[model samples]
Target: MPTSYVKRILDAQIYDLVVRTPIDEAPQLSLRLGNRVLLKREDLQPIFSFKLRGAYNKMLSLGKAELAKGVIAASAGNHAQGLAMAAQKIGAKATIVMPTTTPQIKVNAVKALGAKVILQGDSYDEASDYAQRLVIEKEMTYIHPFDDPEVIAGQGTIAMEILQQVPERLDAVFIAVGGGGLCAGMAAYIKTVRPEIKVIAVEAEDSACLDAAMKAGRRVRLKNVGIFADGTAVAQIGKETFRILKDTVDEVITVSVDEICASIKDTFDDTRSICEPAGALGLAGLKKYVGRTGAKEQTLLAVECGANINFDRLRYISERTEIGEKREAILAVTIPEEPGSFKAFCASLNKRNITEFNYRMGGASQAHIFVGVQVVSDDDRYNLVADLGDKGYPVVDMTDNEIAKLHIRHMVGGRAKEATDEMIFTFEFPERPGALMKFLTRLGDRWNISMFHYRNHGSADGKVLAGLQIPRKDRKKAHVFLDDLEYSWAEETENPAYQFFLS
Candidate 1:
């Protein structure tokens, strides 16, 4: 059944342009997880991504007439560069339509390859629509990033290489899924050749089209997808890829942005190479799988698929790595507003490293302090919280609180007494030109914005924590207005972090 793909993968004429990436053993990760972990270093490809293999292979299939007509595609970044280079090598003009929010690095890389770059829309789906229209208007062939059979076959070559490189038995192979091409290709080949080897498909929790599809027993579209892992932030699985993945994939694992950050750190520790969020996704799932299954001494492989991340994003990724690895705990603790209360709280911490401390005077009786503590394990974090509570310091763990980690930790302060009837909401929207102003414009002047906090994480999405003074009588109407804004948001008025720090 899968021999067709195997044949195509073997015959893919990509070696001239695509490098055979090496597989490296991750000694640190293996020792830490108690499992033999291997990394397929696709990040070392000439384009610093595995995308070139597929793009070049697909271009090679084109006849001279089609090549003369030129080619077009929509990509967030990596695939655009790959296709641009492939088209240039084949002497075909290439046009790339990329999302406006795509990192400037990728935009420049594609332009450097002599491709016509058009920035349109804020998401991949929207840019794809524009690319399709251009393809029709310009009479150019559209090279799909992950949906085509040629593309899938090209990606399958990675699996074939992995099998050939690893002489030892592998219990499982973790593959990252965007529109499911890589997973579908690898899983089909793996199952066909070595049916006993498990194929685990990893996806970002916020962009888990495959997980959603698997649950529904059909492909499903997501209303919104987080773009931290922009390479994999696809809203839906591709039709052909899904057809193969539905049956071939043995399991699906969804990881959080923080977990992905932690995996990037882990990859760096072992490989000394930085990985983009999507590149580290498979490793994140492998870590999660090891944690859940506790299958010690087992051999596993994960694909590091890309390294096209913007340098500026490292700050945000570094900030979240500690928490992602369960090495840091953020908490809100209430102690007496007395002079020695600080010392007493410190004593209760059992000398654990304090990563952060944010404090502001509250009322005369109690003081709310935002503190970050280094921890060894989840149990250690729980014990620290218990110890604080036992010492009569009322504590609320903000470690898993999204608002706390994203916004509150940086802007913690006393309550806003004058900002009455304030409704706080956390929002995420595309990070593009005038996006913030556009959001504010849509919010309108009906209610005063009492509090606002925003930080750029160098991803395609921008996050905002806004507080608006909406009277109780008009809250339902205010909600209606927010819904009409069409941005992904959630009410944070009841969040404990907000209650302790900003309410």
Candidate 2:
């Protein structure tokens, strides 16, 4: 079917019902991509999303009798708020079914809109199933999050707004795909009006329903969905929406979670608004596509669809953003377990500030240490590995290792030990430029250092673990030196490994 019917309906009412979101020229992004890039600021909408446009359009299209019977919807979050707000405005009852795992902030937001919230199942699919059942039982109209023709037509209004706002013709428009509703609707309208402009759909690699569906030539269920981008963590694309997107979208791209986080931070740098990971998918695709094709002088648009990010999650996003950009490297180093061995290892490092260090005595022979370093470019990584190898200490780069990335970053070795003349001390000091030098200088000749470990946890304060080998008779003198030290230190002299290995 021709998009003319949807276009006609949009012209008649959607243009007025939906807010005309801004399409600002992004100079920073343009310089990065070597293209004239524009951003559609749908994130600034009243509901902080483009979802309101579709939900309002769908509700407004229903007849008086249908509206009187009320509406039911299942959403991860944004859609529920959209439908609830629209229904309240139109004097219609609304019931929203959301997954039990949905964030409390989103659940409370829907409740604030006067919708009766029902928490069901673990995922959107399960909530959807419950909503479907409620629809049949209560005889309420089911307002799908992204499937109906009305919702699709409403979302297409974004294209109309983009065309009106950007004077120059666009080479392509990138939209984040969840159930394909936004892409299907926007592509249908834009392709019909501006056939030369290409429509691209972007999805999270971990939750790429449209990409998989296109590959299989039919819609297929995903075995697992990534929760990082909860807004687009869909298991399957909508049937009707997929039909429209299959032919309309020129390309589908899948981006990693880290890529999406980088894009989110990039958008924040440009606009200072925190965009949810799903909302940043379009920008991520723009970066990847522009790099791959090396296409310049072309006009491009990315939809900033939503900005409803959880405040608590911002810390994690910020921490990972630089890492995602390859601006930091984490490594595991195996150094000689002998006197002055650590001092020699420190001398081998090329003066780059040590970001983190952690070490624990594995046995009587050797120690395993974790280290983090900052780097400027990809070539710096090879140089670092070669430099360590040249120093006779081989390093295992954990920058790309999944297990090390997630768990090992926070864990420090604490193996069992037996007590002997060997004593373990924990020291805390202000992590400054020359703090390590002062500590080492203070205890220079008083004791023989048997083992040591230090790791900076992205903090200004420093914590160090040291193992000292001393004669049992000299314990009294060792206590006097430790007590006179300026820094805070604790003695773990009766440790099991101290007796078993050090003795």
The TM-score leader among the candidates is 1
Whole-model lDDT, model 2:
0.79
Candidate 1, lDDT over the whole model? 0.92
Candidate 1, residues 161-257, lDDT tens digits: the string is: 9888885799999999999888888887888888789999999999999999999999999988889999998999999999999888889999998
lDDT of 2 by residue, 1-503 (tens): 53753564365364444578887777777887689888899888777888988898898889998988889999988999899889888889999999876766678888999999998876799999999998889899999889888888888888877877775768999999999778888888788878789899999998999999999999999987766777888999999998888888899999886778888988887877788888999998988788779889999899999987767667667766766655677777878788887777777776777777777676576766777778764578778888888877867776765435543455456443443356777776654457678778887866667667676432223567677878889988888888888666777555332332233
Candidate 1 accuracy as TM-score: 0.98
> How does each model score on TM-score?
0.98, 0.78
Give Cα-based local distance difference scores for all models: 0.92, 0.79
Weakest ten-residue segment in model 2 by summed lDDT: 494-503
Q: lDDT: which candidate is best?
A: 1
